[model samples]
Target: MALRRTAYHYYERRLVATLPAERLPRHVGVIADGHRRFAREMTDGEYRASYEAGMRKLEELIEWCAELGIGAVTAWVLSTENLARPAAELDPYFEVLTDLFHRLPRVAQRLHFTLTVSGSLDLLPPDLALAAKAAADQTDGIAAPTMTVNIALCYGGRQEVVDAARSLVADLVAEGVAPEDLPERIDAEGLARNLYAADLPDTDLVIRTSGESRLSGFLLWQSAFAEFAFVDPYWPAFRKVDLLRALRDFTRRERRFGK
Candidate 1:
């Protein structure tokens, strides 16, 4: 076991060394998937344990991104669709999520990153929403942060687009624009400006774990030209080597950005 661990570390170091800093992604998006399946398969349906492990893995992912000098990371921790699950299945997960939010501010401070929770907070349970907001507030005052972290809780890409459109319409109305002129005022760039994390760069790469090969509405607009890497491990089991491998693959791609 010790020998295998040593070999693994050596390989990881080599992989990191091979990646060109200039080729690394400026922004990364993660769809942290398969926690429930992992619980059923590995922990005999102990969901809280699986959730806790997944959250820990997320913290590790942030550290890894920071070390690589990635400018921003957007992680989808919970989705609007996920809220439809039975309370028995979701309550424990919510508890785990709330705990994660409580703990994340300290992590953000230590890592020198500004944290933002981007999602429909109105859709989440009151306590969970409050906890997430508090965490964001705690990290908002960081000065000249080294990186930015976005936690997508209760988020749905399509909903985000709809919200952005509504916001644009409201702004146009407030500006006293006539209804006919609204069509001309509304464009892709206009909608982009109203998105949840409008200030962040477009996603450069999106990583989804648990062998899923589809985006499923994650970062629907922002990832219009992002590369993807789908790995087989569940979120809880995702490793540093897995992330390194994804980064290596991203660096090899020739991105044309829709050209």
Candidate 2:
């Protein structure tokens, strides 16, 4: 055990020392998958316990990002499909998410991060939605946050794009733009303006834990040319070393946005 621990630390230190800070991503997105799986492994299948564990891990990840000088971090906390889960499981999850939204601002403020929530506010319960909005409003004035953390709850990429389109058309109509001129006016910028976190930059590196390789519709629009790193551990087991490894790996890649 002593030898193994030594070797682990040696490798971790090497990775950290060799990291190219100049190549660090401006924005990183994470899909925190397999919370229930991690929970089952740790607590003999207690779903609520698993969620709590995952939340704790998320807090750790945010701190790690700040330590690494990552200016923006986005996490997929919950999806629209998750809303369809049975009440027995969903009820506790809702409470956990709501508590997270309310508690996150305090943590972010202390960490000097501007807190922002993305996705469909209408889909969240009233109190949860309000908590998210209040948190964002409170942090928006931070002139220079150490980082900006985005919690994506009840978010779907396709739905976001569709919503953006609808909002764009409505604005155009309100502005008295004729239907024939709509096609000329509608473009990437128009759609992006209406998407959640429109002011944020596109994802530079997207990491999905638990060995998942698919995006699962997390940030379809923004991650068009992003690099990906899929790790095998469930989210709760994800550690700072794993994140450093991802960063090290990213630094080695040669990104060419489709030439």
Candidate 3:
């Protein structure tokens, strides 16, 4: 099984590399879905392997983008709806993601990628927020390529827009600003500044695993023109080859931006 998987991964990369430069996308996003179902399908030892392997697979995607000179990469680590998952499972889920968030600084240190998170802060427990913030700040002084690692937690693009508008309206009202003057005071760029990924690049591609077809309200506004790829493999079974396959598939599409 291991050998077969390894060979498949190699073949996928080769397929992607064969694409013309003009076929490639500049940015990529991943929806890492379905860890628990994978765990259930495996024995005790195999379960651990799948979990760890999935993580390394995620790292490989990041490394691949950096090597290919892709502009940015985003991962849908957690969605706003995911917060409502069963409490029994939620604790451990939070633990695993937060652990990754904290260790991301080390990965950034080695990979030269800047990391950022976009979502509702109200949804995250305080400590996880601190860990996320710390990891984000560590990149401040380091010089790296324009690689960006975006993690979405409690993030809904529509919700984000609503929140930004709400906050801006509150502030403007407090300042005694008139309603007629609002458009002149706050434009689209100003609204974007209030978004979770305000400073990050808009997405160019979004890959969702586990046979899911919808964005589930992901970085919606930012993903306006992003190429969407749905892979049949579940998140835990997700591999580097699948990522390359997604890229290869993306390469075949003509992103005209409505001409």
Number of the top-ranking candidate, with lDDT as the measure: 1
The lDDT for every candidate, in the order shown, is 0.95, 0.88, 0.76
Worst 10 residues of 2 by lDDT: 96-105
Clashes of each: 0, 0, 0
In the predicted model 2, the residue pairs found to clash are none
Model 2 agreement with the true structure over 29-56: per-residue lDDT tens digits: 9999998778668878788888887888
* lDDT, residue 123, model 2: 82
Q: How accurate is candidate 2 locally (lDDT)?
A: 0.88
lDDT (C-alpha) at residue 259 in model 2: 95
Looking at candidate 1, the ten consecutive residues that score lowest on lDDT are: 135-144
User: Comparing 1 and 2 by TM-score, which wins?
Assistant: 1
What digit string (tens of lDDT, one per residue) describes model 1 on residues 1-259?
A: 9999999999999999989999999999999999999999999999999999999999999999999999999999999999899898899999999999999999998999998999999988899999999999999898779999999999999999999999999999899999999999999998999999999999999999999899989999999999999999999999999999999999999999889
TM-score of each: 0.98, 0.93, 0.86
Residue 117 CA displacement from its true place in model 1, Å? 0.8
When sorted by lDDT, best at the front, the candidate numbers are 1, 2, 3
lDDT score of residue 114 within candidate 2: 95
